[model samples]
Target: MKLREWVEAGDDARLLVIIEAQDVLSVELLRRQLRDMGEVSCSEQQAGTWQLGLLAHSCGSLDVCLARVQGKVAALNRGRAAAPAELVETRLVSAAAASLACAPMIIGPFTLVSQDELECGPRQIRFDGGKAFGSGSHPSTRLAVTLLERTAAELVPARVLDIGCGSGVLSLISARLGARHTVGVDICPDSLAVARRNVERNNLSSRITIT
Candidate 1:
């Protein structure tokens, strides 16, 4: 929906970056580069594939950015022992299509749902990004949540302090798991805003503090 709004507001199109690779280090680097480019969201297509959605203001600019990224990926692959298949693929898709492709992600006992999927149960985490990062799709996010669940289970009534909390997923999770108080701090204003909205959406504003 945000992508649709961007296109409607005069952006050229939304470019979908499809990547199939088993290398975690390479994917993390590429994700960082894409994030630097502009608005980007990552979703795992399957076991070893990742879909990165980016808003393109101009086709020419998109092409140049892709070329630069491909060059960097190629350089990184040169050092690897075995290269993955079809490391990079591109497609221009409408916002509706992108939305469907980037569907809800189930992380541990929690499910990350968007605005459209509001009929979720108590374990659902509703997160709509306003140019903020972390949607419970990345491997790191999933792992972090898994670890949090393990630790939080043992530590009852714990207080959580999340530094650089993007989207406030961890803080929300801590509160949901019965933490006494949760504090999420972030340098990015967009992240703080999104985190606060998430806290309110989950009705954990009393227990979770976003700043």
Candidate 2:
């Protein structure tokens, strides 16, 4: 699940630690070490580089965990003298929804509506912003939705696959637009968790699946 969800669901305080790794190997090593202390989540930032996020319920154990990570990093950078990894505490901010253009987006016959916005018609898509990316505000996602709108007629009763489906927005939209089945796939477990919630929120769980 998203860190924000976990933080809000539990009564205990949660800590989020973010770190930048020099390479994929470093990220893997850091994840393995941190997993012993708490839940570890990693995402690739660029070629050969990655970002690691560690979440824990106990604040008292954070100091010891940080110290152990520092010791490990120091040992790894002993002789070669590469730049040490950067680590910091981070806060989770809730994402807000907004219209893509000047007005509510009109994709084919369906209108995309933000959670805060009132339902416009029967063909409305209710989407809310979440910790996972792709809230339907990004230009790339808008473009994809537009393409799907234009070609929706040709895709009736089709089965769709959405790769790297962050929030499962496209998959939900595809199903609403008449696709018989939609499957959303992502490498991040947190993303899939959010996507599953989103699918259920839209009442399209019968046609959408997140993996």
Candidate 3:
């Protein structure tokens, strides 16, 4: 069934809509259209493609918003050269589903422990795993952590700046790896909020800054 039809058929109060866009322009277009209805998070899935996660409160509102967005995108595609935007997946979830989805696991040089895991062993990191993207589960986040480890090994006391630093995992890792300081920057307010929380949870607030 189509995405709108699927949403229209459901009674879920909260919905997660995952979208894929070939370029930043397309991603921004979708964000602009849906910004008023919900919170939008953007993360790069590959070199040129990006995945957008949008959390909306009501399925009825989403059904209507999506219809309007589809029409706008169609009109834009016909009049401009920007890439097309499309929804890839949708799911029904509770408010804390994102945090509940995160489980303790090892990622590169550090251990990612959920916030509930009180006793953090050596190299264990605690995070709330709120609505932010990085929970150390994604392959991209893992690779980034690994590369940071290798790079930090050669340069102790180095400062780091992480752009689009969802959940501030990389910044936290850099601080743990003996970086003098780290700054994390992200466009999504939800991501920045969670990243700040994680920074505090790990007691790395002195070494890391999120904005």
Candidate 4:
């Protein structure tokens, strides 16, 4: 069983801790221990998995959140250090953890994500199971979109490239924002799949090309 929990100390602060175990009792022990930090909740999931979520507080700004989490993780290292796992194997680091918090961004009539929506945005972009890649939830992408909205005419770059396009959410957003023409490329095929579905979901296949 694997248990994961997150706590936000501020608008953009995010802290996540996870415990992995083979037996239920061990998992329960860790869950109980972590619970003392803040509000605790657990939901039994399929395949004998239990998800534990936590909300905690510590003094700091959003800028310090990542550094603080890194410090905490470093403090926990105690000595030995293994290569960081790609996925959240037993820890989450530099992961697009926007779900750790969410901020509302007003797009047209409805609000797009403004703060940490990745932490709150649907796990799957429009429910494309295997799709994985860049999250529009990042502040960087959100801010870029805002800039694009205002200075697009003056800063009209002939071609736009997303170095690490994830689920194609941001790329599609560009198309939806009127880029004349756009193409989204991702190193991960799953992300490409997700982007394609997202395009179709928004019916933007005609505007944005996904590769």
Best by TM-score: 1
Q: How many backbone clashes does candidate 4 have?
A: 15
Per-residue lDDT of 61-162 in model 3, one digit per residue for the tens?
A: 556766654675566567566666676776555554643322244567677766556687769888645556665546677678778877877547678889
TM-score of every candidate: 0.66, 0.47, 0.52, 0.40
Whole-model Cα lDDT per candidate?
0.67, 0.64, 0.70, 0.45
What lDDT tens digits, residue by residue, belong to model 2 across residues 162-195? 9999878788889878898899999988779878
Identify the runs in model 1 with alpha carbons over 4 angstroms from their true place: 1-13, 36-62, 65-69, 75-78, 82-89, 115-120, 128-141, 151-156, 187-191
- Candidate 1 clash total? 0
- Residues 32-86 of candidate 4 have per-residue lDDT tens digits of 4443343333333344444444333333443354344335434444463532211
State in Å the error of residue 163, model 3.
0.4
Native-to-model Cα distance after best TM-score fit, residue 18 in candidate 1, in Å: 1.2
Lowest lDDT 10-residue stretch of candidate 1: 51-60
lDDT score at residue 153, model 4, on the 0-100 scale: 68
CA RMSD, predictions in order = 5.5, 10.7, 7.1, 15.6
Best by lDDT: 3
Query: How many clashes (backbone N, Cα, C below 3 Å) per candidate?
Result: 0, 0, 0, 15
